[model samples]
Target: MSSRERVLAAVAGVAGIAAAATLATPGAAASGRYQHWDDTAYRGQIEVVRSADGPSDPTVLNGTVFVDRDRDSRHDRNERGLAGVEVSNGREVATTDSRGRYRLPVYDNMTVFVTQPAGYQVPVDEFNVAQFHYNHLPAGSPDLRYGGIAPTGPIPDAVNFPLVESRLTDDRRLSCIIAGDLQTYDLDEVEYARKGAIADLARRNDYQGCGSLFVGDVVGDDLSLYDEVKGLTAQTNGPARFLPGNHDLDFDATTAEHSFDTFRAQLAPAYFSYDVGNAHIIALNTVRYPCTPELDNADGLRPECDDPVNRPRYNGAIDATQLEWLRRDLAKVDRDKLIVIAGHIGLLNWADEGSAIHQVDQVREVYSLLHGRKAVALAGHSHSIENLRTGDSMQGWRDLFGVQSLPFPHLTVGAIAGDWYSGQVTEAGYPTALQRDGGRPGVLTLDLHDSSFQERFTVTGESDRVQTQLGLNSPTYREWYVARSAWNRNPVGAAPELGDPLVVDQADLAGGTWLTTNVFMGATGSTVTVRLDDGRPRAAVRTQAMQGEDQLVGPEWSDPVAVAEQLVHGGSVADRTMHLWRFALPADLSPGTHRAHVTATDIHGRRFTDSLTFRVVASR
Candidate 1:
């Protein structure tokens, strides 16, 4: 018989038996108790409908549906067949047959969802939100920002599924895009972000099939924009996922644990794990609520922490339950596969004070869990670029937690809105320079091949370049120097002696200092020393040795106009800002010129040196 006809016959038979059971158990039925049937009651008879054309003409599909007696969302032991349960797709509804099977019509762009019964729950995504769809249109639909179901045709037959009464598990190789902190509080900024970022993704086919995931801080204090954020995401070519950050939490939430209630209800899973393509991705909720008692003070803020509004504080620590769950989850994963952990707070950031609480305190514990394997951790609260290549030993943890750095890598991904969408607008109608290192705003694409992964930062509208280290020493360096001097607290004085370059006479180099335009930062054992052409080497002092964060320190120019003029004319100046040094040579160095070379070695023992020659003028 045809699939549809077979489904009808099975349903007819099951209905007859159910009617007889109803009569036999009249007294027992009063309490809503009935003999649950096993899978054998309706073996291969039930079917589901599918169609390759469109939802307009769907075919029958053969599948099994069980009665979740335990009321858990998952299919578990002792759960019996829930025959006659009705499943539907707005247009058609079918009841489970004798074997707890049901045949229903399904179409692309159409939702074939089970009409969740009173005590039963449907499946939810990683965000712990119920799984629902607008519709499935393989070919896509209209241009609505939050596009609903597409108008694709019907799918294949036998698209039957099993629905249990317990929390469902979805372990699929998902391709998800992660965007950080779309913290748009106002409509204009929201539109700007949409025009710049949302518009860019709307037209792309790269993440079409796979959905997108926004790491956190979806909105500013104005939680009303959650819908607007969702609207923008709808414009994308795929589904969108979200995680909450400090800003996303409801400051007005009644209780500490309920801070993310509204967010949870709206977006789903707050913290969850999913598997995709040989990698296990875990999204954590690090922001705690209830500023009164303080949630563990992970950020080092005390119960009386000072804040104008006295709002709750946040830091990076999982609750006991979540921590336990994490340990269990990590235990289930294979060591050989990559484990990608993501959160709103970075393990390390340049924006925050050194060793902030938002940074993982139990980093060693987490690192130890994934020890001896390839893993990648990502965070985004800080809108900067920082890569920590902690060697195999987790030694860095010894001081903090008797732990060290793991062999794996930890990276802080730059924001989709680099520098809070700072800087001047470019020809592309977006901020071109938002990163501290002068890197443009964009997304990070990781390509995994077997056990290893290659990461590339693709600047918006540019080609992919795997290089992460930035190189500076040309005219760009000069411009930076001039800018630094113009903002310096000290200016240059009269000229110096024959062999001496411009020198600053002891000034406060504490704050707002500007050294030279050329800054060479190196890791431990890496040196950045400057030498005069006359064979006299200037001793470089260790301004700051930030094992946790990176910083640049040096001298500054008191007079900015002179520095700017010198920079314009390619002349020299004496200043230091952050980690740079500036110097102007004397006029009478044999009337010829001399060379000053600057060399830097990285932690890896790689050396780079650059030298510049200046023509010495005769003292007329």
Candidate 2:
């Protein structure tokens, strides 16, 4: 594959990933020519007064799936309905009739949504956000901290959805953006998002009709700020969809049933299914809230674990209803179609890696259900990016999930608000929130070709070609890291000791230094190699084998760039990972500047090339 080489001339003032590629400038003026839609479509709820009469019957949510011949979001006199499109209202599902009309039982605070059928497109707002659902909360949120949901007077007589004809969803290729954890906790963080990932997404046109799926943690506990985050998503050139995260829970709800009430009122179903071309997207609600002892008892000591009454807690498990719904939902989907399952806590991860509280308890069951299907799982909440290929294994997964190998590609697809959007602020108004894994904040795109696909991670403000971070892990840097880590844990007065980490001297070389490549989406079979000064390319060894071994951590396994930035700022340490490659630097090199061209090949055999120029000086 050919790459567009972006010279430094086109890269000035561009921060983060944008500075590394030949894409649009990070914060450039826009032409305002992206897909536009109705922001006001999200009708707020209305307070329903009880005078011995509230809504007693299931509100009739009737609608027609019409083909907008002229791309308008309204049914014209001559326009006809598109039959067989699936629609749902939280629980009970229904299909459009032959005449493109259908009705579902909707209750107060229930969202009536359509599972976008193949070969057709939904109406997208100005920011290319797909408008395919309606909020039906006659009485809005029962007043809480984050405002919850506003009141929608009464159920509409007819709730219709408009879709236009498009070849994008009909084609073999499905362009999907797996954006995990846009966890904006406040209004200021919302601004940071606008300047960062949102800016980068706004500049692209690849995923216009088919959208980006923000897996979880759309916000950081402040549900009222949802509109603020949605404002940021309005900049993308694709339809936007989301799954709920633990931070999105309605903490005031005493029972599990009402825990995600705010989330359901605001975003999407607690758990639902959708489709785009050949892929069947299953958005599951794996988080069981008020996760008291009755649910999550993995903590060694729990006397009242069986007590059913809810308390403030969260667990990683799917309830009977959701699981049963999943089975029934999958029963209808064609076996040949790719199953794209997404959630928040992740089926498994490397951060908590193998804790029972983090991974779902029914992973083996999920694996069993997906037997013989071409599938992949996407998740977040661990605040790290992980691409666990088929057959990949770790001790945690084996011990907790009771599985020795991954059945398919289970990508803990990083986070949009990387590391809780932590780190120092940038000129663009966003933080340089490098993730806990040392990866810069980013989104993952799955380029689907039939049942198979190529996964690509785009660092915010960076291009697709920018996939790896190169660093120098010298003895001096390692020592400084150790001192700094201790100082952080116990706070000493003395500052950390370290020199210019990138530059090496004779004594430093003798002490052993390595050139490290932190391949962002690298998996078990992925290989990274570096060639110095256009010389022979020596294969760089991956730090962790992911073969049932304990995670390899510390400075040797760390990404120097992430460590440097995160250590200065307040956030989780990027001390260990499943995707880092290192190469020992030659001590006998000539003392001038030299360029190292590194090539990383993913499991699918696609190559991403990156280069860095480093100096070998006498002193720093």
Q: Report model 2's TM-score to 2 decimal places.
A: 0.85
Segments in model 2 whose C-alpha atoms lie over 4 Å from true places: 1-64, 68-79, 101-111, 124-129, 134-143, 147-162, 298-311, 587-594, 615-620
Error of 1 at 536 (Å): 25
On TM-score, the leading prediction is 2
**Could you give candidate 1's per-residue lDDT for residues 1-620 as a string of tens digits?**
43223222221221011111101211111213212212111112112345555334345544455654443434445655567555544345566777766666554434444433323333333322234222334554433223322343545444343444421112122234567778887887687677776776655534422246677888876777777776777566443656778888766654545566556545645666544456666777766554433445434544432341455466555565556656766665678777778888864443343443556655656766676767887777776544445542222343444444435565566667765665445556655334443334566544444445544344454333111211112232334554445544344663221121221112211112222322222223445555656577554433334343234421232223223323322223322212233333322234454455555443444444445443333331
1-620, model 2: which lDDT tens digit per residue?
A: 01111111112112222214334321121223223423212212211223344434446667788887766566777888989888777666677889898878767667777777877776655544456777766777675665556787776657777776666666566677788898888888888778888888777766643578888788988888877877887777667887888889887776776777777766667787777778898898878876666456655432233454543667788887677767767777889999999999888777776567677877888888889999999899888889988888888888666788888889888888888878776656677778889877888887777777777788877666677777778877788788888888888797574544556777668888888888888988889888999699999999889888878878878887678767756787789988899899888877988888888887766677777666787765
- Give the Å shift of residue 166 in candidate 1: 23
Q: Assess every candidate by TM-score.
A: 0.54, 0.85
Give residue 289's error in model 1 in angstroms: 2.2
* CA lDDT of every candidate: 0.47, 0.74
Position 242, candidate 1: lDDT: 68
> Worst ten-residue run, lDDT, model 1?
14-23
